[model samples]
Target chain A: MTQDAPRNDRPRAVNGHAPDVFKREGQVPMREYPKNAPVDFVIVGAGCGGSVLAAKLAEAGMSVVLFDAGPFFQPRRDFASDEREQEKLYWLDPRISDGDDPIELGANNSGRAVGGSSVHFQMVSLRFRPEWFKARSKLGYGRDWPVDWREMWRYYDEVEEALKISGPIRYPWGPDRGRYPYREHEVNEAGLVLARGAEALGVDWAPTPLCTVSAPSGKSPPCAYRGMCKIGCSINAKQSMLITYVPRAIKAGAEVRDLAMVGRIETGADGRATGVSYYRDGKWRFQKAENVVAAGYSIETPRLLLNSSTAQHPQGLGNADGLVGRNLMVHANDAVWGEFDEEIRWYKGPPSMATCEHWNYADDDPSKNFDGGYSFMSQGPLPGDFAGTLTSSTGMFGDDLLEAMGRYNRMAGLKMVGESMPQVDNRVTLADETDELGLPRAKVTHSFCDNDRRLQGHGRKFMSRMMRAAGGKNLFETQSTAHLMGGCPMGDDPETSVTDDMGRVWNVDNLWICDGSLMPTGGGVNPAMTILANAARIADRIIDARFD
Target chain B: MSQPFRTPYPGYDVLDKWDSPSFDDQTREVLRARRDPPPRRFLDPNQFALLEALCAVVIPQRRPEPVPIAPFIDAALHAGRGTGTRFATMPPERDAWLRGLEAIDAEARAAFDGRGFCELVRPKQARLLRSIDRGDCRAPEAWQEMPPQKFFRALLLKQIVQIYYSAPAAMSEIGYGGPASPRGYVRLKVGQIDPWEAPFGTWEDQA
Candidate 1:
C-alpha cells in the first residue's frame, strides 16, 4: 500500500558504483564525445534491442551513440540481491493509467534505466511460437508477421547464442530446429512442486529457458539461484543488456550517455531523420548521427516519434497514417496461488522457473471461449514480481492478507500470460501531465478486452486444479498484466503500422526502431527473446541495406 | 559455492556509520520505527491512541510484545503514501486518514455506551469494527457519505495489514527471513530446503 515517491518526485541522485570498471558517475561517463562528432548511429534507449543493435552495428564498425533517460545501474555496486533495494532500477516517469482494468504503470510497464527493462527482466527467454507468426492467418485476429518464422529462426538462434541462453539440451518444444547454447539450469523446488501438480492435471511443464547463465562465462557467472533475478541479478548471473550487450557495444566502441533523455528526432525538410535533441546535465544538447534507432521501449519510442512532428511530416514522423501511438498490447496476465501445507519456500531459486504452454492460443484452442490463449508461469506463490507487482497490482491488504504474509513461504503460485488483442483504442498518448523536464509524460490507456478476460478465466480453472493436486488449500486468484508489446507495430502497410519488417519507420528512411516498440503482437509468451531475435533480424537488414 | 548460505553471514564487518549502509536509510528507519516509534507527526494524540487500539483489535498480537501498527501507518500518512488507488468517494490519503480516524472513534463512542474506541475492551472494539465493516455505523461523517465497507477496505484494513507485515518481528514469528543484502537464496528445487528457510512439519511428507 506504500506508493513511494515517484523517481522524479525529487532531484534524484544515486552514487556511482565504487567497484564499477566502467568510468561512470551519476549515470555519467562512457561518453564518446567532445560532444561534437556526428556518430554513424544514434540509438535511443539502451535496452534489450538497442543494446544489441548498438553492439552489432559497432561490431560492424559503425560509430554508435546510445542515449538512455535513466541513470546507469552498475551491476556489482548498484544491484542489490534484495528486491526492496533494487527497485531503484525502475522508471518513475510521469505516467497515467486508465482503462476498465488499468495496467501497472509504475514498475512492470517498462524500465527507464540505461539498460532499460532488461536490467530487471526475470530472464524468461521463450521465443515466440512459429504458430504465433501465423496467428493472423490461422487465428482470425491480430496482425501477422510480414516475415515468417523460418525467416527469423536463425536470428533467434544467433541472439540466444550471443545471450548464452541456457535451456534443456534437447528442446523438443522449439519452433525451429532450435537447440539451446547451454544446458538448462536445474529447476528449483517450487518448479518441482508445480511440475508434480501440473503432471497430476495433465499439463506440460518444463525448466523455463532462461537467458541467465547455467555455467560461468567471463564476468557473467552461472545463476547462484539467488532468486534475485527480477531485482537485477547480483554476481552478474542474469544477462541483462547492462552486463551483456551494452558492455559489449561499449567495448566495441559505442558511446553510451546515460541520463540523456532523447527529446525529439530531428528531421530535415527532406523528411530523413537527421539527428536528435536531448536533455543532459541541466541543459539542452543535440547529437547528430547518420542513422537513428528509436528503441526507447514502446511508449517512449512512439512518444519521441509523435513529438518529432515537423512541417514536412507534420503529423509526427510517418504519422500521416495516425498510427504513432496506436495499438498498445500487454499480455492479459492472471494468476492463482494456493496455500500449501508444505513450506514451498517459493523465494529460493529464480522467481519464475517453470512454465506451462498447454493453452497456447496460436493454433486456436477451441476449448477457449477466446481466440488467443495463455501460457502459465509459476511464481513465489508470494506476490508479484514482488516489486514489479508493487508497481503492477498495488499490494493486496486485509486481515487475511496479514495472515498470508506469515505463510508466504507456503503458497504455491502460478501466473498465466495469454495473448492480448492489439486494440487501437488501447493506446499511449501524450498526457496532460508533464515532468519537470518539460516533456509530456506518456498517457497510457489500456483496457482488457473480452478475449483477454475469457482467456484468463480459462487459465484460472486449470491453475486451481494444479494447485489442488499439489496439496494446496484456500486458493486465491488475481488477474494482472505482463510483457507489454505492440505500441509501434511493424508491418508492410505503413498506414496500419509504424515500422517495416526491417524496423524502419515509414516516411523516414534512416530512422529505425529496434525494441519492443516494433512488435505487432505479443505472441502468447514472454517477449524478451522475441524482441532480441527481431532486433538481430532488424540489425541484419540494417547492415545489408544499400543506402544511397 | 552455488549452495545456499544462511543470513547474517558471519561477516567480520564494520561499525554503524553515516557512509556505510548495513541497510538503506528508509529500511533502517522503518525497522527503527517498528521498534521505537516516533511521536505522531500526522495524527494527534487521540487519533494515534484510537488507531493503536483499533490495530490491536484488527490484528490481535499481544503475546510477548505488540507489533505497533500505528507508527508505520502514521509515517506513511505523514509522508502522504497510499495504495495509489482509492474509491472515488474517499478523499486523498492525508484527509482520508484524518477523517477516518476521527470517524472510527465517533462510531465507538456512539455504539459503545459513550466510551472512546481506545477505552473499550477488545471484544467491544471488535464489535464496533464489525459494525463499521458492515456499514451499520452511519453517524461518523466519513462513514455517513461513503460506504463504511469501502472505507475499511481501502484505508483502514489495507493500512493495518500493511503495517503488520512491515514489522520484521511479525515476519520473524512466521519464520520469515529478514531482508538481508549480500544474502541471495540458492537451493530452489522442489523438496529442497536451504538451512535459512523455515522448516515446516510437512516437509518430509511432501517429499
Candidate 2:
C-alpha cells in the first residue's frame, strides 16, 4: 500500500509510509477565492461519462469544469517506474477499497485513480442486447423505460465513431446481416481449441470486440497480446479515459481539475442548483455553476444527492419520490476451467477476445423460468494471475505440485457473464464509517436472488459441457460476483425515479445524474459502452437546451 | 517502405527512465541487509537434482530442451515470501516438502544402496516420483502437513509455469513476445455494427 504525499515541497518515501504527513492532517490554510465567477456546467467525476460530456460541451463552446477526486497522473511521469512498482502505486494498491472483505464486494480491483475504473478494466467493448431496454415490459419485472432501443442505438453509433471502436460486425454463429464490415484476429491455438470445443457442443464462437486499437491505428498501437489487460496498459492500445476521452476534453478547452473532490451540492430556494462545494489541496473551495452533472458511479451519485440537504427540499435534492438509492442490480457471473492434453498457451492475448452469446436472450417458455441469456468468456488470465486464481480454491504445494504450475501456462478457461433481474433490496447506502478524508463511505448490501443463482448454475453447466466438447481435461467450476447498478434509476414517472428520461433531476432543473446509477436495469453485457453512449446522448440534449 | 510505428505517447520516453531502477544509498543498505545465503531447501544441489528427476517424469521434455524445473522451485520459494503464503505457514510447508523428497531418497537408497537418488538411472527416478505423486511415500508427518498429490499439483501448475512463461526460450515456443513485442497486430474495418441479438423479445410476444 503506497501513500501519496502532499503536493507541496515534502520529501516523500517510496512506499508512501510517512507518519508526519498523516499527523499534519487537516491543516492546509484555505485561501478565499471569488465565488462569483460562474460557469455554464460543472461535471463531477471525470470518468468515461463526465470526460465525454466535457469534450462534447467544450467543443460546443460552453464553459465546463470537470472534477475528479483522484489525483492527476501523467503516465510518462507518474507511471514511469517498472511494471511492478507502477502496479503497486497506480494499479494494485489504491484499487482495493478499505473495508472488511473488499474483494467479495467487487471493490477490491476497481480503479479509483484519475481515469476511474476504465484504467483497470479489460477494455472489452460490448453493447447491450437490443431487448435489454424493454426487459421490464417483456418480463413484468420493472417499469418500462421512457425511450426505445432505436433512440439509444443512434447514440451508440455516435459514441462508437467518437471512441473509434473497431471490431468484427457479424455474429459468429448466425446468418450474415448487411451490417458494417467485420475485423478479425488470428485465433491463437488456445482460442482455436475453445472454438473446436464449442463446435463439438453445437455452439458457436468468434473473435471478441475489444476496445484496444489493433495494427495501424493512428496514435494508438496494436495490442502486443501480453494478456495483461487488467493491469494498466503501457502501450496506448487500451482505450482508457486518460488516453481517449479526457485528452480530447483537455484539447477542447475543458478544465479537468483532478484531485478535486465534490463534497456537497448546494441547491437554490427556487429548486435549481446553485453550485458545488469541494475539497482540493487540503482546503475547502466553492465553485458556482448554473448546471451540475453527477457522474460519480452507481453508488456515489445517489449518495451525493442524498447527502446534499437544502431548504427547498429537506429530504434531499430531487428526492420527492424518495427513490435516490434503490433498485440496485448487478450481473450474475461464473467461470469454468479446462486442462488439455496438448499445450494451448492460453495466456497469449487479451484477457478476453471472444464471447458466445447463444444463451444471452431469455426464453419465453414458462416452465423453464430462465432468468437471462449468458455470454461465454473464453479468455484466460496471464500465468501469474491464472495460478493465483486457480490454486485459490485448491490446496496444492511441494515438488510434484511445482510441475503442475508449468502445465498451467497451457490451460484455458471459460466464464459465463449472465444478467441478473433488477431487485429493489440489493442497493448501496452510506455506511456508519467514514474515509480518511472525513466523508461517509459507500456501503453495498447485495445478494443474488434464487433466480440469479439458478441462472448462474445453469450457465456453469453449459460452460462445462462446452469445455468437454472442446476436449478439455480436468474441467471444473469457478466462483463469480456482480457489479452494482440502477440505484438512481431514470424513468418518465417522477413518482418512482430520481432522474428524467434526459438524465435531468425531476425537481432540480439544472442538475443531471449520468453514469450507471441512472440505468433502470442491468443489461446482459458489459456496461462501459452503454454508459458512454448515454453520456453522449445527454450531452447533446444539454447542448440543445442552450443554457445561459 | 519501412513504416516505423509512431511513438504511442509523447511522454512515453519518461516511462523508460521510470522503469529503470535508481538505487540510492539507503536502498543499497536495505538490499545488503536483505541478502542471505539461500536456505537448505533451495541451496542444496541435491534438491535441484531431485527436482529435475521428478519434473522429467511429470511433464517429460517434449523437444530439445525441457523446462528447467529447479530454478522455478528456487525462485518461487524465494518470491513466495511476499506474493504467496503457501510456503510461509507453520512448520514451513516448503521445508516439509524437502523432507518428503529426502524420505523418497531414503527409500531409493534402501532399495538401491550407496548411491544418491539421481544416480540410480531414469527408471528408478520415475518409479520414485510416481510413488510420491501417488502418495505412496513412507513419511506420514510430511504427508499430513502437505499432501503429496496436492503439493505435486501446485508445484507443477503454479511455480513451474511462472518460470517457464517468463523465459525468452519458453516465450518463443508459444510465439509470444510479451506486450512490447513489435510483431503485434490488430485488423480494423469500418461500418461494422455489433451482432448480439436482443436478450428480450417484442412487446407482442410478452403480451
Candidate 3:
C-alpha cells in the first residue's frame, strides 16, 4: 500500500509516480524477468482481467509476466481535467468499423493504457442478473453460459470486497446479497431527477453500486465527486485496476511489462504453446512461458488469435471451429435527455449515480416485445461530451446549439444498458490495413437486429414518459453502444464456442482466454464487475489444475 | 437568432479557479497551453483561414476573443490524432477534412459568382453549410469519394463543437464547475450550489 496522504490540499506530482507512492509499506519491490527465461505464465493485456489474474496467480506462488500494448500511466500526472487531453487514455489506434449499422469505437468502449478501459470507465459495478446466465435455458433466447450463476454470485461478492464497492445497504434487484463493502455515495441532482422519474413510474431505484469508495479505504481517499469518472481519475479514489489489482500483482512478484505490444503467440511442433513474440523499445523479442493466456478483451483477443495462425492451427490458435471472432455483442446504450426549469447541474458527481433494473427482469414482465431487457441510469456528462451529443442528436449548430447549450446546467439524461442479440455476422476480422506497429488492424462489423431495435424504441419511449412525468420538457433520444463483449465466448460445446467454462481454449491445451471476450451474452448491466469476477474464477481454476 | 444567444451565467469566468486547488498542476498546464494558438503545422494558410471561417459558423462567439478551435483541430490532425476508428468507405480523417473543405469552397464559388467560402456573407456561408449537412450540395466532384453529410456529421460539426465547449470560457458560459480536484462539490441536491460553483443565473453584480 502507498504511504503518502494529500498534502497541503494540492497534488504533488504532475506525471511520474502516484501521489501516494511514498513507499509500499512492508511490501516487496516489483519483480522483473529476463526475456529468454521462461516464467510459469505469460499473460497478454494488463487491464481488468489480466491484472486481476496476474495478482491471483502470483499470490499462488506462480511466476507471471503481464504485457500491455499501452503505457502504464501514473494517473496524477497523466489524467487531465480537460476531456480532449484525457483522450490519450482511450485506444486511439485506427480500427475499421463497417456493416449496416457500424458501431462507433473508442472512448465509449476501448482503452489503451495499462489499466485498460477500467482507467476511464464510469465505475458502475453491477452483478449479472441470475437469469442472464441461463438465457437460453430459462428465457429461451441467446446462449446459456457454461458456468452457473450461483457460483458466479460468490465471486461477485469477493470482487466487491476487493474493490471496496460503495452501494445501497440492501440492493433492490436480483437475489438477496448482503451489504456492499462501503457506504453509498451521496446522490446528486441528476440522481434525484432519476429517482423522481422512477418513483413516478413506480419502479425500484437505488444508489449505483460503484467501485469508487465513498469513504477513505486503505491508502486511497474518498471520491471527491470531481465528476470526471469516465476520464482518468487523478485522485486515486476510484479504485481502478491501476490502484487495486495492478499494485497487488506487482507486490506479489509479478512482472508487468507495459508499452510492449504482443504480436503473436509462439507455438511448437508438439502443439503446445511455448511463448509470445512482442515489440518493445524498437525491437521484436520473445518471452518464453510454460502457458500463454490472451486477455486482450473483445476485439484484440480474437485479432491476436487470428493473427497468430500457425502450421498446426492454420486458421488461428483457437479458430478451428471458426468461432474465435464470432458473435460480437455490445450493450445498447441509448439515452434520453430532457430540460428542467430547476437547477439540475448534472456534472456534480460520478456519472450514473442512480439506476433502476426494473425492466431487466424480463420473466417478471412477459409483456415485452424482446427476449432480453435493459436498465436505465442517470447520466452526468461533461460539457464537451454534452455539446457533441446535442450536435449529433439534433444536428443543431450556431445559434440553435448555443441556445441548447445555455441550459446545460438544467439538462439531465437517462441512459440504458440494453441487451442486444449476438449474431454471427457481427464479428472482428483482420483488415487489409496495418497500424503504426505494423500489425493488421481489426475490422469490426456489427448491426442491430429487429429485437434490438424494438428494445431500444421501447426504452426511449419509456424514458421519455418518465422524464415528462417528472416535469421535464423537450426530451430527445440518442442511439449509442457500450461495453463490447463476445468474440471468444465460453460455452459447453467446443464446436460453438472458442473456450470452455474456465476460459481455456478448446483445441489448445496450454493456451487460455480471459476478459470480456469470453462472455457468452452481454448482460443488461455494466460488465466491469462481472468481468473481474470471471477473471477471479478463472484464476482459481488454473490454480486447482496446476498438477496437470 | 433567438435571444442573441445570451449566457445564463454571465460574468462567471471558469479561469478564476486557474490557480485554485480545484485544478491540479498538469490540468493548469493543459489549459494554459490551449489558451494560446499553437503554430500551424498541418493546414496551409488558405485552408487554415477557411477552417477559421467554417468554425465560426459552427459555433458563433460574441466574446472579444473567441477560443481558438481551428488551431487545436489542425494540431490534432498534424499529430494524426484520429478518433481511433473511421467508416470503411471514408479516407483517413485528415484526407476527409481536406476533401470536405474543398467541397465547401466549391459549393460557395458555384452558388455566389466564383467567390470562395471565406469571401461569402454569414447567411450565404450558413446556407452552403446547411446544404452540405442535408447532403443537397450539387458539387459532387469536390466531395470525391466522401459523402457530404457523412463528412459534415462525423468530422466538421463534431470537432468544432467539442473544441469550443472544451474551452474555459465556453464551460463558464454553460455554468460548468470547470475542474473539481482538492475541493469537490458538496450540497448536491436540486437547486443547490456550492460556494465556488457558478450560480444558475447572472452573477454580474456579485462579480
TM-scores, each model vs. reference: 0.82, 0.69, 0.95
**lDDT per residue as tens, model 1, B1-207:** 011212221221211221333243444543453467656798888888888887776666644867666886787777555442333355556777777777888888887777888888776776777677766874656454755665675467655754554455554545544443344456665566655554543222254
Candidate 2 C-alpha error for residue B144, in Å: 28
Question: What ordering of candidates by lDDT runs from best to worst?
Answer: 3, 1, 2
**Model 1 misplaced regions, further than 4 Å:** A1-31, A174-176, A310-315, A361-366, A381-399, A546-548, B1-167, B179-186, B189-191, B201-207
How much native contact recovery, as a fraction, does model 3 achieve? 0.72
Q: Give the alpha carbon lDDT tens digit for every residue of A264-321 in model 3.
A: 9989998788999998766888999999999999999999999999889998889987
What lDDT would each prediction earn against the true structure? 0.70, 0.60, 0.86
Candidate 2 chain A: worst 10 consecutive residues by lDDT?
A: A13-22
Residues A58-85 of candidate 1 have per-residue lDDT tens digits of 8887888888887766565555433334
Q: What is the TM-score of chain B in candidate 1?
A: 0.74
Q: Give the better candidate number (1 or 3) by DockQ.
A: 3
Order by TM-score, highest first: 3, 1, 2
CA shift of A107, model 3, Å: 0.8
Docking class of 3: medium
Estimate the lDDT of model 1: 0.70
Which stretches of candidate 2 lie above 4 Å from their native place? A1-36, A76-109, A172-182, A310-315, A362-369, A395-404, B1-207
Q: State in Å the error of residue A55, model 2.
A: 1.2
Give the top-scoring candidate (DockQ).
Answer: 3
